[model samples]
Target: MAFREGGAIGTALGFYLIVVSILSIGIGPDLAILSKIAPGVLWGTLLLSALLSVDRIFHNDYEDGTLEVIALGPLPLELVAVAKATAHWISTAIPLVLMAPVLGMFLNLPAHGFWVLVVSMLAGTPAVSFLGAVGAGLTLGLGRGGQLLSLLILPLYIPVLIFGISTMDAVLVGPGSFSTSFAILAALSLATVVLTPFAAAAALRMNLQ
Candidate 1:
C-alpha cells in the first residue's frame, strides 16, 4: 500500500531533505553551531516527516470499508492495528531514518554522533508509528483530521524525542550516559508497541461503528 502511494513517501523524503538543507543554510557555515544543533534538528525533522503520512495509515482502508472487512476477520483488531502500525514504521519511519545520516553530513554532525544518531532514531521511531496509530484510528473518518492528529500525537512523541536527542548528545557531549538514555528510548518504543494496539483498536472500533 505504501509503495502504491509513492507520492507520500517521496513527499516525506523531499520534505526531510529540504528542511535539513534549509536549516543548514540558515545556520550558516559554522560547523560548530551546526554540529551542536544537528542531533536535535535531524530528529525533529524526522518526526515531522513521519507525521506527514500518518493520517493516511487507516484513512484509505476506512474510506473504502476495507477496515470493516478486516475487522470481521479471524485476526483480532488489536493485531490488525499492530499490522498497520508496523507497516507504517517500515514504509515511512525506516526511510526517514535511513536519510538521517546523509542529512547529518549537511549539518556537520560529529563523526561519533552519526552512529549514535542512527541508533537512537532506530530505537525511538517505533513509538512514533505505534502511538501515531492511535491518533490515526481516532480521527479515522474526520475531515481535516491531519491537524488534529498532529495535536493529539505530537505530545505523545515528546518522551521519544527527548530520549532520542539525549542519546545522541550523550555520545557527543553530555552529563548523561548514552546507554541509559538509549535504554529509556528503546523502552519507550517497546512500551508503545505493546500497549498502543489496544488503544488504536478501540478507536478503530468506535470509528467503524
Candidate 2:
C-alpha cells in the first residue's frame, strides 16, 4: 500500500526498463557480443533497479510512525525487518525476475541460458531485498538518502551480482560449474535471509531511540 500510495511502483519500473533499454541500444545490434556481456549487463541493471527503491523500504513507515508501532508489536523487530524486505522483493524484484527472460532476448541470450538466467535471478534477488533492508534501516528517515543508500548498498551487492552472472556463465561450462555457481548464489541468499533482518532491526532501533 505504501508503494502504491507513494507512486514508487512506476518510478521503480521506469528506472529499470529505461536503464535496460539504453544498455540494449548502446550495445547496438551485435547479438554475439551482446550475448557475451548480457549476463553482466542484466545483473548490473537489476542492481540499479533494486537500488531505486531501497530508500523507500523504511522511509514511509518511519515517517508515519508505523515503524515504531511495528517495533512495539509482539513480533520481534528482526521479523519485521524480514517482512519489509520480503515486501520489497515481492513488489520490486520478482517483477524484474519474471521480466529477465524477455529482457534477455534483447541481449540475444541463447535458449539454454534463459532458464539459467531465471534460476540465477530467483536465487539472487532475495539477497538484494534483504541487503536493501539493512541499508534502508540504516538510512531511515533520511529523505535524501537514495543516493547514499546506493553508495552504501552497492558494495554489498557485489557478491550477489558476481555470483548471479557467474551462475549464468556456468551454463556454458557444464553441469558442475553451473551447480557450483548456483549453489554459491543460493548460499548468499540464505546468509542474507538469516542475518540481515537482525542487522536491519538493530538499525531501526537505533533510529527509533
Query: Which candidate number has the best lDDT?
Result: 1
Model 2 C-alpha lDDT per residue in residues 1-209, reported as the tens digit of each score: 32334556567777877887899899799988888888888889888887888788888889888877777879898988888898888888888888878888888888888888988998999999999999999988576878888889999999999889888887844545888888999999999999999999999999998
Query: Each prediction's TM-score against the native?
Result: 0.96, 0.94
lDDT of all the models against the reference? Answer: 0.90, 0.85
Over 4 Å off, model 2: 1-6, 173-176
lDDT of 1: 0.90
**Candidate 1 Cα errors over 4 Å, as ranges:** 1-5
**Candidate 2: residue 11 Cα off by (Å):** 2.1
lDDT of 1 at 4: 26
Tens-digit per-residue lDDT, 65-115, candidate 1? 888888888989999888889988998899899999999999999888888
**TM-score leader:** 1
